[model samples]
Target chain A: MSDNTGTKVKGQSCRLPRKRFYRARAHSNPLSDSHFPIPICPAEFDYSHHYPYFFPSGGEDHKNGSASPRKVRFADIGCGFGGLLVSLSRLFPDTLMLGMELRDKVTEYVKERILALRASNPGQYENISVVRTNSMKYLPNYFGKAQLSKMFFLFPDPHFKEKNHRRRVISLQLLDEYAYALELGGIIYTMTDVEELGDWMRSCLEDHPLFEAVSEEELEADPVVKLLTSATEEGQKVARNGGQTFRAIFRRIKFEEE
Target chain B: MEETAEFVSNAGEDSASVAAVTMDVDNGLIEDDKSKDAEVAPALIAVHPFEKSVAVAVGFELRLFDLEGNCSVSLVDDSGGPSHSDAIRAIKFGANGRLFASAGDDKLVKIWATNPWHCIRTVSAEKRVSAVAISHNGHYVAFADKFGLVWLIGLEGDNAKQSNNDKKAVMILGHYCSIITRLEFSPDDRFIASADRDFKIRVTVFPKQSLKGAHEIQSFCLGHTDFVSCLAFAYPSGCANGYLLSGSGDSTVRLWDFISGVLLATCEVGAKVGSLEPNGTEDAQSPISDLCASSDGSIIAVALQYSNRVALLSCDFSNGNLSVAKVVTLEENYFPTSLGSSSLSKCLWMVMGASNLPMPGSAQLPTRLRIISGLRKDPSDYHCHDPIILEDNEVPGGQKLLSELQGSLDVTKEEAALAAAAAAVKASMRNMMIKKEYTLERREMRKKNRNDRKIK
Candidate 1:
């Protein structure tokens, strides 16, 4: 149908605008900017309507006054078609998960897909929900710092231009945000068919102050890593098109006891 | 910190939200505890685990504290939220106080986590929820709304919202248009008892897993002329052996054998006791707002709507007799909304909602609800202040007034009146006039002053 998913943004990282949620068009400014600015913090973001159970965002915990009613531990960033989210839902049935997408139409598709699955399975998919927002711009508004245990960056757009490198999903500044939202031992999973983009994400996390490269043996042990090869639509498309996909996983370094 | 949650009961936490009732300590009787703070709105109190408890109130402002003095987490504070933005109609704790659930006028049912006291799951209904009941297993929460439907949601299953099919409800039972005001699962969780505003209580068999037997009505508790507001097991902590006690708007508390659907005893607590019954109103102070039975099934507490009083009765399930043991009077202008009792500590907890400051001259605004609990053996030893302590005493405990329990003296007269009305509905007013009304025909004969008086 219509690809209203990506809008051409002007100024900074890369001058030639083909498509970007990753790189800026101008080198002067590399920070991701959205025309729709979000709230300063989560208190301004009401998520009651988005949750399956009564999250009473308006109603704080009655037992202890200060505790948040709930915390979102699973997040799927740039969840294009929500394929990974839907697939990963079965793997972590008890976990409350959320998907943040940039396009309204795609987000609607994910919601409808989730709704259909829920209706078919009754009381099953409520743990997973989707919202339409640019994760790079408003991730903190949805998840509290150190609230997430696992995050997925599956098959994000590969901005090939050398000048547009800063626009990639896994970049220097965004790594700090990712590290902030994840627990000390939390894992960040990145998968892409483009080897160069995969390498970019690997080096970005490697150089981040709060992150350390996960061992290959440890990566092999994670159940979620299995889905990286065949879960998302883009991953499946890459596999069907005879393209080699790459995976890079990193762990938050501080406060990790083991 | 390792939290060692001792055996906790369902009475609830301290402090309150909307429309709270408190007992003042001056006379060792219930006194209205007014809101010293202006920001708190009104809320609802949840009846819970029959063991030792911490009263939990979710409302305009929320308050949760231990009534038994063993609050490992010490969750007492003046806070808001964890309640419906509008009003919370009912809240009940699951079996051992492991789970808590509340229904609000917002048509939302929130199942809360107890240790931390947060709403973990929110279930939406088609109508404003009237009552909430947790299953004996503490896993399923049964709720009824303004609409006549009964919904059962399993708390342990995948979130009700995620299921592909409408698997959230184990089964749904209903009455035509009457609102279901209370729901209770038998101690065995085999049968679910439901009460409606239309003066009906239906007990339906709860199938082990599926709701296939939901349509199989076990029995019906009838005979109330007004709405039945609350129900409690005759033996709350026992085997639930086919006996239940119900309180109604007709200002009567009745004991029934659920298996036979027969009325056992009807104890009158009405106009004779100053219930402030409103003329021609079907639902008002005349209705029993809340009722509970002690674990041993020896005592049942009745709180009348707007009566501002709690009547403790000695219940004999064997002969189906209910005798008023004591009438705990709340002095001052106070409104009693809910009553809870813990069998473990034999503590009777009452929640009262007061609106004004009770000053020399102050405007009446429905301010706050207070929660107080007292040891049943010695009612005077009750505490309404020092909320977190067993001295649930915020004020003086309510004074005990010894009064003879009024037997069903009004039953025959009320039955006759009900029969007359039933006939009136069947025949026209003209037909009824021609048929000779009972009081009217006698009145005419008496006015004539015939030799009938000489014969008598």
Candidate 2:
């Protein structure tokens, strides 16, 4: 398998090489055609193109017994280098998780990484994938209302200067789109080495009506929270430097009226 | 180190001084590599009534610091500390600073005694809260949530009501289908103005006689192209009537005369500020993040999203005209996320947030709170200081760490470690199951093919 890197592979999915992954700025969202050649609509987006394997999107039954109206319940926003996704892929073998990233190169790298993993382990890594999209703008386009169950903002890029705070994925306005996409009781997990960014996420989510801050006790009980601090490359980098990872988990909650 | 200082007023000039964060990349003034380690920025801030102490709310913790002593106020056994489970969105001190009210995503509104900082009453709402506002007298605490429903609960009555039965919160359908960002009661308390994400501001009469009348629309401040995030009232003419100023996602700030329901003036901060931006043509939308106007309404400060500068507008409500006083640029894309004004000589507090825009060598920079003092007829000085970083663990002194959060919560590091190990084991087992099932299926398919060939 190691010698087959340059050779043509046949698995329905195209064999993406490790070197093909390059960094390109996120084609700013709503793809106004000026930045991107074509504007994107959620309806026109074909999931089959990204996932070479057949996924039963409530339309057909699968060869394997796992075939209920299954959708990508887990989403990783700004998934830098796809470290967390690859880690979680084996954990939940059946759960479909999509990593939405801004940088084209990072997204390509994640897709290729997923392909390589799938090649090595047959029937595994099929549920994980990546897409290049700026969550700040096109989150609603990718995710439908109340469609997502879990969203991970792991080691997010903290806009250091105050001016770029809006560019930070977790603003009050963007939180609205997040809440819209997340189902009630859906948990949003955020881990950051930067305490300020952690505080910003906590404050924004706590201020919004859709999310409830899951206490550390509650966060610890869950298996997903465990992956936040150590699963990602950024998290690993922070650990190497002896820095603190402020892990905040918020659950999407609403009253009976909502 | 003062760069170019611009003043709409003395206080405005002083506010610019705190941190002195102005655009200096083009001027080659900033060293480009000074701030490392991201700092905790202020989400909401309240200056105590005594004027000696100010309460700055960052994330979920609310820390009260004595300005004179330059130290945080240590509460009784962390009783006066942050109690809400989520972020503290709204924190406001009552007139004279005796009482402070707060509400957040915890769906609870807590009013605390400012002296020792005791949590006197906690009012629970049905939904996660967005904005909280206390009346002029500080009796009724009104809060809004994601649904744009405003609920008011009385602080004093809450004590007795909790003893018997929880008093039903008075709900008002303030803004339609929009998340109400800012809710404020007028100085006279005649009307309460609410702004929402749908780009509309509604001035409704306060529920004086009946709760039903609380939603009575007095006038609508129309003409904002984007969602209004912050609202403030200013008495520019020094008259009883005031003008409402709103900052919005459209990167514009508009002043509206609530009584007449007229659009007074629009100050487009993004256009001028974009010129100073390095990559303005990269096609990112800039929104107006936060704003605050002085009591006199003489100076209005607007923080535009993605721009390193805060635009200060000097407006006169008398003639419905606004002029851009100066666009004070911050140092190297450092944006102010929150701003507060104290009446004592009209000082302005600016909370700085750094852009995480993948620069060459950008590390997590620390949060800085800059206070511009002497806005009135006094000496101007901008003081930029580090904010109080609230630790997650240090709640109290006595109890066992795990026991304090015993009932529904258990947050010990050991427990988390155990849970993590278990999870890793479970994940590996699941992966093995998938592999086993795949191999078995292939074997079964081969057996079927062999049998069919024999029948043939």
Candidate 3:
């Protein structure tokens, strides 16, 4: 196969050159056009005295040593506004799911949704969360390698204009980040409304040495994929307006660097 | 070096001296006695109160610091194989710290055995695993991912036949257009409480015998206007209130009776909370990043992210009232707060600070637990420093903070070698050429422009 750079990709799905990979940048205060201005947490929340629990330390002992292995299986990358997050929690009640988003507004929105979910279904929705974080910057922060069984990027900003492509959430550089974050056999599931953006994501995943397509049939037939089609806020919008929603699933393949 | 210092109480011009005091981090003690007199109080961040140690996730690793700063600090490596390659988002220490559970973007919820942290088992997920909360008895490990999926893993049966079996992934899904942010098992282990982005709290009662879903929708706590960031059950320390406090993007920590779904009290903090205008209208603010209550539920700590402060208030549930007791100022760079404390650990709560440390040179991203220790001292006793909530906030408050965390630095041997290799490569490509300066006059003109704007 030709390198991403060697090929002048015709569409968004084909792999682009490494140079086309997103160059991570800080978010601009995009103009918010809303009736009530979205609330944001104080920038300097005084943690001066409180300690943040980075690791498990409380009363989490398995009463039965034979109990379930303490393990996590699913992940969300750049979970914006957490629309998909709420959907996934109900779809896979037994599988642990995590939502990673960069914006505080988005994460906070998800937080309220989670608390309410837990309040209503204390038994079922207690296993989900939307963490406030820049996914591109912190994939390894929350998870261990090969730890995830699946990952998703749904309708992430395309950074459409050329100069802003570097700011796009998905790119060759981010592909490596995902590749390392995922376990062997783990899958990366992505969806985009823009065909060009879909091509961009496809190219990013396809070009990486570690990932290969899970087959079109597998992508279409997966039950979890149904949740993407039926439950997402954007999915509803796509259905209503007759907009196209393209999705691709890539599994991590074994690779030897040496 | 002193930047501009703001005061909670208007003292005299000499207040600048009080603000200038730096922490004597080496001695595990505050060097200045006079600065202690300042009224600026400390607020709680994230609280993870375990039995032996109160664990906090800062950046790449989890810091298992002492609850009272009297014991030795323990560190756990949260890096995912590569150098600084993992973010420790949610960490829960097993009973007696024998086994600990952690989850992050790596999509793996790893259960580590004690002493030398070894990954004994892992719960693999399809997406970034954001939150992991093991039951008090550790029978079920509940985890939520970015996709808003909640998974209940029953540890009772792990027959090898189940190995390599996709059948193990039993997921419960529902909740449209929102992400699940935080989840916790009720004190009895019979129920679970979860918070999501949609500003709703759901309670599910589990079956008595089996770890399977009880399918019982008990009640919904429906008052938060924005995402609820943190949720905690009333610690069963003689408190029969059965209350649940939720921190939200609305900048208020609302207390709810989990069983009845009644709004108990809303502890407001920051400009948004005080924004009750002269005309009784104010601009709304973001949700509280973190929340923690005392054992008796007398005091609740709210960590305000954009507000740049932490506030402690008295929660008078009997009358549904809240009064701000004190607010502590924090450094400007910190964001995304975490809070933790135990039943007796109420007077002092942990706050995780300066979580997202932009890598000094690169634009690469970061993790769940990037922590800094001893950023603030408990004002009641200045000599007593407590752990802040950042997961890496594991170090003891004073002298041993760095030494204790020396074991869990996210850097790996392979990554260290790669760093050395990269350094060598860069050295080989070095070009010794000095650039010309634009001249002192130009620099001064730029500085003057910035200063003029500040004056305005």
Q: TM-score for chain A of every candidate model?
A: 0.79, 0.83, 0.73
Interface RMSD after interface superposition, each candidate? 28.6, 18.1, 19.9
Model 3: CAPRI class: incorrect
Query: Candidate 1 — which residues are off by over 4 angstroms?
Result: A1-258, B1-43, B47-61, B66-83, B157-171, B211-213, B236-240, B276-285, B354-375, B378-456
Q: Which candidate is the best by DockQ?
A: 3
Q: Candidate 3: what lDDT?
A: 0.53
Q: For each candidate, what is the lDDT? A: 0.58, 0.60, 0.53
lDDT of 1 by residue, B244-331 (tens): 8888777788888887567789888654345542232333335566787765666677776545456777777776777776666653
Per residue, candidate 3 scores C-alpha lDDT tens digits across B163-200 of: 43243544543222134677877767767777776566
* Model 3 chain A poorest ten-residue lDDT run: A46-55
Q: Per-residue lDDT for B362 in model 1?
A: 20
Q: Cα lDDT for residue A146, model 1?
A: 73
TM-score of each: 0.43, 0.46, 0.44
User: For model 2, what is the error of residue A167's alpha carbon versus the real structure, in angstroms, after optimal superposition?
Assistant: 33
Q: Stretches of candidate 2 above 4 Å error?
A: A1-258, B1-42, B76-82, B156-165, B210-213, B237-240, B275-285, B353-366, B377-456
DockQ of each: 0.01, 0.01, 0.02
lDDT of 1 by residue, A1-258 (tens): 123223233532212212233322121111212334354345445556666343545675333367655656889998877788888889887677888877666666677667666655666776788887767545655665577999999888786767445457787646655776788799999999888998888887776656778898887788888888778878888889899988888888773212
Per-residue lDDT of B1-456 in model 2, one digit per residue for the tens? 223223222121121221222111111223331232111123456665456566656445565665655445654433333467665667777755777788876777887776776777777787667788878776677889755678876656433455423565677543433467789888767788988765567776665542433523456676675567789888755676788998876767888888866777887767656623334453124666678776677667776655666667778677777777666665554545566665552555655422221232312222344555434432243343212222224322112311211211232323332222222222221221111112355434433433223443
Candidate 1 interface RMSD after superposing interface residues: 28.6
Question: What is the interface root-mean-square deviation of candidate 3?
Answer: 19.9
